[model samples]
Target: MSGGVDSSVTAALLAEQDFDLSAVFMRNWDTKDELGADGKCEWEKDWHDVQQVCKLLDIPCRMVDLSREYWLRVFEPALRVWERGMTPNPDVDCNREIKFDALVQRLGESAQWIATGHYAHLQWDDATHRAMLCRSVDRHKDQSYFLAAVQEPQLRRFMFPISHMTKPQLRELAHARGLPTASREDSVGICFVGQKRRFEQFISEYIPPSPGKIVDEHGKVIGEHNGLWKFTIGESSRVSGLKTRFYVAKKDAERNEIVAVPGRDHPMLQCRAVNTIDWRWVWPDHDVQQVLALQTKLGGRFTTKIRHAMAEIECTPSQGTSPENVVLSFAHPDAGVAPGQTAALYLNEWCLGCGTITETTCTADLQESASSEPT
Candidate 1:
């Protein structure tokens, strides 16, 4: 439930139905080691809220500690990606690894179906005999992108109670029903990071300082960086002593250096193609064959989103260097496409699946002739 308004309302809505209802709050983070900014355990507070909501709903509730599962499955893997100077979407991993895989296993045969407050829909596909992940009616609040890595089996047993309604509508219902969390603000950003600390500050505690050089596009050292993990591609390189603003164009992990370019719309920031490793499809067999056949017969016909909230871009998918790898060729150069980020695939409103980007082909070559020009 996460002790949020959406989940509270979800429980309330379900209580009116005849189905057997039991609320289980999965504690993915352990706050015993570290407290919040207010010097109180964050998860404890959330668990309290969950208890209150469940009490009002009159459902049997329990707390399932999945911190160990989350640490081994999501956090550790994400830390490795961060150490390599690549962006990692931990939320996507949490949905697939913790929520769907570990939590479902914990329930075992006790629960027939799992429901959540995620703003995504599940549609049963008659042709494929599988469940398809679809976008919520609230387009702005759609979260299908995060669930792209979830396989068909998990999708079949999942349900979203608030998928058909908008955020405002849901909140209104919560208010009418007197949900305690009716006015509670929605949670944002990564869960463990919390709202108090900067991402760089939070990550620094786990990763030791590995200082590196920050170089310009011309290969001239401009400044020093505390760590490559602190910087992300396409974000303004807040390096001191620069007359004009610069943005991070690339992270050369092998050299332990960052490539910064002048201007926000620099050619070096535009990525023409993204190559993903360990590509996962919701309907693994059928979807793989479908994309391959489409590529062979008619180039490609798929839209992809490298990150959430951004509009999907038309892309042509083809087999990458290996069978497990997939290359998504963007129709237009995409800026800020970073390695380690999940590239979610979709056919219109239906989310097909996603892959973790391993490399990005940029448009830096087009600007080689103009590189010598003074900034």
Candidate 2:
């Protein structure tokens, strides 16, 4: 249950329906002595809350330590991506690898279905005869982006109890039920790791900083960075010595440099296409080959999102340089498409699939924008 309002309410609502319910609080992170802002091991506090909720709801609650699985499956792969100077969306992998894959195996022969507090919807598609991922009724809080990599098999055996309610409404429901977590603040930061330590700080434990130069697009040095792993594509906070506000345009990993630009709409930050790997579709009937063919032949259109909480943008799918890779071509240049981020595809409200961005096609017509580049 994660000891959060959403999961607490999920258990409450399920209990209300009189379905046989048992709760499990998965302890995926095992960082000893790593405390959160509240000066306690985040998982320990969360386990206490889970126990309280289970007692209040009169249900069985169990704790499963999946620290090893999480590290091997989610953390290591993500760190490898970071080592490559690319930003990986570990949350997506967590959902796919840990939450669904490992958890399901752990629950073998015990439960027929699993439910979570994720803010996404699932509905049966009659045409496709499959359960499709849909946008939550609370559009602003939809989390289909994070859940995009979850396969159809895993998804079919899942339910999201609070998909129809907004965050405030969820809090109200919990409050009315006298749930202890009603007033608890929402958890933020990395999926498993707490926000008590900065992301760079947490990463530094493993990846020691290799200080490098920060340069503009033309190879002119502007500043210095502690490490390339500490910066993301389009990041501006870590950069300095620029006269006007500058956004991270790109990271030259080969040169061990962070490229900065004065304006937010710098050409390097904008791309006409993004190539992706590790593609997965939630719908069994859909495939990348068909999507590419449709886009290339019939000029089919779909909606896409590079990161969470952003409005979906219309895009066209096409074959990338390799068979395993698919490229998304946007009508206009898109900003902040970092390699290793997900390219979540959608059709209307249904989440189609997601792919890991590997490369991007910079805006070709940057002559005018480059002319005004910061000197």
Candidate 3:
């Protein structure tokens, strides 16, 4: 359990259904590793809440130290990306490697299935004889994108009890049951990195600052940055130069430089096509020819979600530089397509798959087409 209303409600609902349940709180982070912790671990509060909930529900609760696994599987890879001056979504690796794979292998040997509080749905397909991931009824809170990397075998052994229920419904149920976390505020920011520290401060602990020059689109140096890792693709450049605010457009890792533009919708930040690395399909569509045929039959049409909780945007798919890559072309030139970010594909409400963005094709037409409106 996450010591949150969602997971607590999940356990309560499962208990009501007479299903045997045991709570395991995976301690994936140790505050002692942080330079600014001052010997305080924030997860203690979560642990206390978890134990209280378990006691109230009359169920067994245990803590598993997965800090080593998390560091190896999630942290190392992300650190490499950050060092290269690119943003990486650690949650994707956390869900795929730590939560669904390593955690299950460690603790779910005897259990018939594993359940979590993720807001996603699973449907058994008679035709394919497989479990397909679907969007939750609460579309506003759908988490299928984050679960896209979870393989079919692991998905088959998973369950989401609150798939059809909304967040308000979960809070209401928790209040009725007198759960201690009923009115507790939800956790925010990165999972292991508590919100108490700024995101840049936490990241800088792993990736030491490398001072570099900030340049405009024409290679003109406008300002200087403490580190390229401190800025993301779409964030506003705090460095002073122009009359209007400039948004971070790209990073030159070799030169240790950042590129900023005049507006948020600047064409330099817009791209018509993006290449995804290590693309994973939720179903059994692994054969390249089969995938191509399926795309051709569907006219390569799909609704793509670039980030969490964002509305689906129309796009077309094609083969990328290699078999492991998939190239997605947006219906319209899109801004803020960042390398190392997730690009999740969907068909209506059924989540197809997802992959990490590797590269994008920024064309003159795309750049010129960007809106010139001031923000």
Candidate 4:
């Protein structure tokens, strides 16, 4: 249950529904205690708190170590992409790998629906008999943005009990029910392999950062950068150069150079396109007509959340070239689309689905907008 308030309430609510429940905790290896100054992970106190909660509820709360699965399936692929100077979202993969893939295998008929404290909602669209992922009502606490990669069938098999409750409401529910996690602060931050900055350092250890030149749009070398892997498209993180803030315009992996613009107001740097939006099929191996029809059913002016903490932007998605994938165009343009990151799609604050940003065409020209640069 991750020793968090949302999850505690979820488990507690499930019990109230008269379902036999076991509070299974997923020990994700990526949570290596970045909050600590030293390298060692320090979530021991958190686990102890979870143990106390399980004891109080009289449910078997045990840890399922999914470290190897996490590394092999989730971290490795993301690490490789990061090493290549792209910024792919690993949490999307973590859900598919641990939540649906590994958790199903481990729980193995022990539970009917593998539930967690996630703030996203999953229910079968009765007409289509296909699972549809929707945004949680608690807009401030919704996490559908990170759940775009979850398959549709798995979405049907899951339940988010706290989908309708706000964080304050959840806290009140927990405190009233005497759940030990009632006061646990929200666990919202990055949890990749290694620590925060340590992850970058550890990656550089194995993936050597060949020195690259940091240049202006005019191709004048203003300063030196570690390597292309150390930067991402639209990244302004610690780049060396002119006085004002600048964003990465592009990363030339072949030339081992980085292109930067002096400020956010620059047209080229600001003209990032949110394209190649994809919606996954619940049953990819079966006839996809039902899935396509499901997408048609989801047609509406929904909302979109790009960054985790940002509020949802009103948007509408249309049927594109493929049945499984949908083309999403926002009511207005969005910024900070680092290549390889997910353009998470949603409707009514619910996550419809998301796809990796393989290409982001710009508005510079109609033809160029059809084919964007890779992250």
> Which structure among the candidates has the greatest TM-score?
1
- Write model 4 residue lDDT over 1-375, tens digit each, in one string: 877788888878887777777887777763443233455453555577778888887788888888788878987898787767777777878887788888888988777887878887776766768876766778777777777777776676688888888889999999999998788777644565322355566566567767878888789887788767677666684655457987887777678788787666555554334555445533444223443454578665456565777756665555556654455556655555566777666544445566666554444334354567565
**TM-score per candidate, chains pooled:** 0.93, 0.91, 0.93, 0.83
Clashes of each: 0, 0, 1, 6
Question: Mind giving the per-residue lDDT tens digits that candidate 3 earns over 117-184?
Answer: 89999999777779989999888888898998887888999899999998888899999999999999
Candidate 1 TM-score versus the reference: 0.93
Question: What residue runs in model 1 are displaced by over 4 Å at the alpha carbon?
Answer: 34-39, 287-289, 292-301, 366-375
**Order of quality (lDDT):** 1, 2, 3, 4
Deviation from native of the Cα of residue 224 in model 2, angstroms: 1.9
| Residue 334 Cα positional deviation in candidate 2, in Å, after optimal superposition | 2.6
lDDT of each residue in 1-375, candidate 2, tens digit only: 999999999999999996889999999985663333344577888999999999999999999988889989999999988988998988889999989999999999799889999999999967666888989988887899999998898898899999999999998999999999999998776865576678877888888778889887778887888888888777673555557887787887888888888786877778778889878888655776676554565444688999896777888776666555778888777777788899998767878888999888877445656778899
Candidates' C-alpha lDDT:
0.87, 0.84, 0.84, 0.69
Model 3 alpha-carbon drift over 4 Å, by segment: 33-39, 287-301, 363-375
RMSD after CA superposition, every candidate: 3.6, 4.0, 4.1, 4.7
For model 2, the superposed segments whose C-alpha errors exceed 4 Å read: 33-39, 237-239, 289-301, 321-323, 364-375
- Tally clashes: model 3: 1
Candidate 1 per-residue lDDT, tens place, 1-375, comes to 889998998899889999999999998986556443455677888899999888888989999999989999999999999999999999999999999999999999899988999999989877667898989999899999999999898888988999999999999999998888899998889999887778888899899999889999889999989888999999988788989899999998999999999997888898888889888888877445686664566553578999887977998777877766888888898888899999988766778788999888888764664687788
Between candidates 1 and 4, the lDDT winner: 1
lDDT of 1: 0.87
